[model samples]
Target: MGKPTGFIEYLREAPTEREPGDRIRDWNEFHNPMPEERLRTQAARCMDCGIPFCHTGMLVSGMASGCPINNLIPEWNDLVYRGLWREALDRLHKTNNFPEFTGRVCPAPCEGSCVLGINNPPVTIKNIEYSIIEKGWEEGWITPKPPAHRTGKKVAIVGSGPAGLAAADQLNRAGHWVTVFERADRPGGLLMYGIPNMKLDKEKIVRRRLDLLEAEGIEFICNTEIGKDLPAEALLKDYDAVLLCTGATKPRDLPIEGRNLNGIHFAMEFLTGNTRAVLDKQPGKDYISAAGKDVVIIGGGDTGTDCVGTSIRHGCKSLVQLEIMPKPPQERAANNPWPEWPKVYKMDYGQEEAAAMFGADPRTYLTTTTKFEGDENGNVKAIHITQVEWTKNDNGQFIPQPIPGTEKVLPAQLVLLAMGFLGPEQPLLDSLGIERDSRSNIKAAHGQFTTSIPGVFAAGDCRRGQSLIVWAINEGRGAARECDRYLMGSTDLP
Candidate 1:
């Protein structure tokens, strides 16, 4: 440890963010970077715990308890504390292929499992990680490092999200020629479109890495979909092996009476169009605007939060976020102990922005929408909602039960359904004749990513369902190792 008693001496400090009121006017990232000296001081707070559960990378109570990618927290914290910036970057890159992505968006399960967090604040692992990577870039420490030799094997990776990109990087490092296929106009399936720009700067962060990967000899073919633009059979015939990192993107729809009404859309439809409009420097015809409209966002997840932020930027007249689940406790409950992800309430960037603009949190918990009410023009005008209580059903399964006389109508000119995805789209899997699990995810084992068919593998959301970005990277790296082994009858990837 860089400083033995630093944890006892220093209090946890994190970087300040842009004022929500000021930041809502633009589509820029809100987090302000912490100074090197302060970051070092924060890094020094890593206690000398014998078992660093912070990087244990295990699941407790079906949720991630620690860093899923198993980042070397203590080593990098020590390196940062000693001012070994480049060394810290090296240690970071050894485990995480894209720390920049995870550092920004990943819910830091590692901090939850920190040994010090039982009684004291956890170390600022995510901030330190972001600082190290950004520093690496600023100092030009990160550059193209093409493999020394070619293994003469060609591997095709489908989808260019976190999982696909990680696998491509690992496989490319192992001396195999790798090509990534993306269906969207650009690469970065989720990061490019699904996430709003205010959270992650697309061109500055995501594109920079994509360009570097291309410079390192990995090929990215965009605007092409496997099993559609290009035949699935053609991919199998052309490449030595194929790995599917196609994410879970099939959105769960609310098939209510007015679902087909105008001004109502899936969360991705709204988000993707907004991002595309931002990147293009103009809103396209497909862009859904919330300007001067009363916006109602259903589903109280990250997606809904993003919708709130985006709507605020669009100068929405009013905003409301409805969550079916009850509000979480302000502190960790009895069931959620140390190492388990805390089921506590904390305002995310969107809610913070909403509160700054609207003077209160936009979320309304313990509520569910009954139906969408449409106007004469077939445009949604309001939502019929009711409060609900969770009670045991006939099978002892807890379910939401609507309370009598709780129905109310809320005006809404724009409605965005941010409910999560169910699973990956089925067409590609069906076209390739791939096996699917009971949950409709691709039937691929976790550690061994091999699919039912030979010479093919699956990883990330398509296999595990919707999950955090860190888990995608972990699965991608693991899949790459197994794929390399399948190709050469041995493995070196880690």
Candidate 2:
């Protein structure tokens, strides 16, 4: 422990976000970094528990409550407390390939499972992690360290998202040749296109990481789809082993009345186009504009939140986010305990901004859209909604029961479906002849990334379904270790 009484002496402090009014005017990041001295005090608050459940990366109560990458949290905390910042950065990089991405996007389940959180607020692990990496970049400590020698073995990674990148990094470090293929014009799979630049600045962060990966002897082939542009047989014939890190891109849809209306679009279509416009340096005349339009987003999750934040930036006239489930409790219930991710309600960044602007939270719980109402010209005009309550069917499955008198109509010029992804698209998996699980995910057992076919493996959202980036990194490293073993009969990778 850095100080025996550190926890008692210091309280948590997080970096303040930019003012709502000012941040809404642009689609840039809004958070300001905390001063170095204040961050040191925050680091001092780490209790450094003997058990250290924060890094366990296990599933607790059906949710991940710890760091999935098994980060050296305590070591870095102590180093930060003693002002050994460069040392802190080194320790963090040992496990996490990119702390900056996780620091900003991850929900910080480690804090919920913290030992100190049983009584007091948890240590500011996420903020400390963010600062460590940012400082490393600013000081030029983060640079490509390509392997000193090559083993002459070749590995092909199908997707260039977080998992594929991490796998390529580790495999290359083990002295193997690694090449990443991306269907998009740029390398990052979803990181480059699916995600908005505001959350993760594409040019600054994503492309920067891609550049370092390239310099580390990892070759990248962009704008090449395996099943389409490049045949799947080509990859199997050329590489010693193939790692499929394609993310879950198939989105679930709501098939209801007026589904084919002009203004109703898939969330990815809207989000991806907006990002492309930004990258192109202009939204232009063809862009989907929410300006002066009432927008209704269906499915309340991270995608929904992104839609909320993006719509605000476009100067939407009004917005409403609908969730099929009931609102979470304000605090943990009797059955709920500490050291697990709390199911209690807390506003996400998008909702926070929405609340600040609208004087109320934009999310509406226990609601379902029955149909889209369109104008004479076939553009979406309004929405028909019905309130629902969870009720047990005879089979004991809780189902949404619509209330008869609760049907109402609301104005909506544009509607974005933010329902979560179903699984990896079937065409690529089918072409490669890989088996799938009951849930339609690539059938790779946990911790055993090997697929049905020999010398082939799967990782990330495609294998595990939609998940956080931290888990993707873990799977990537694990898959690389397995692939290395397959190639050389013995391997050293973590």
Off-target runs (Cα >4 Å) in candidate 2 are 284-286
lDDT per residue (tens digit) for residues 70-89 in model 2: 99898999999899999999
Candidate 2: residue pairs that collide: none
* Candidate 1, 1-494: lDDT as tens digits: 97989999999998899999899989999889999999999999999898999999999999999999989999999999999999999999999999899889998999999999999989999999999999999999999999999999999999999999999999999999999999999999899999999899999999999999999999999999999999999999999999999999999999988988999999999999999999999999879999999999999999999999999999999999999999999888998899899889999999999999999999999999999999999999999999999999999999999999999999999999999999999999999999999989999999999999999999999999999999999999999999999999999899
For candidate 2, report its TM-score. 0.98
For this target, which candidate reaches the highest lDDT against the unseen true structure? 1
**Model 1, residue 262: displacement in angstroms?**
1.0
Candidate 1 local lDDT, residue 397 = 100
Q: Global CA lDDT of candidate 1, please?
A: 0.95
RMSD to native for every prediction? 0.7, 1.3
Query: Looking at candidate 1, what is the lDDT of residue 358?
Result: 92
> What are the runs in model 1 whose C-alpha is more than 4 Å off?
none
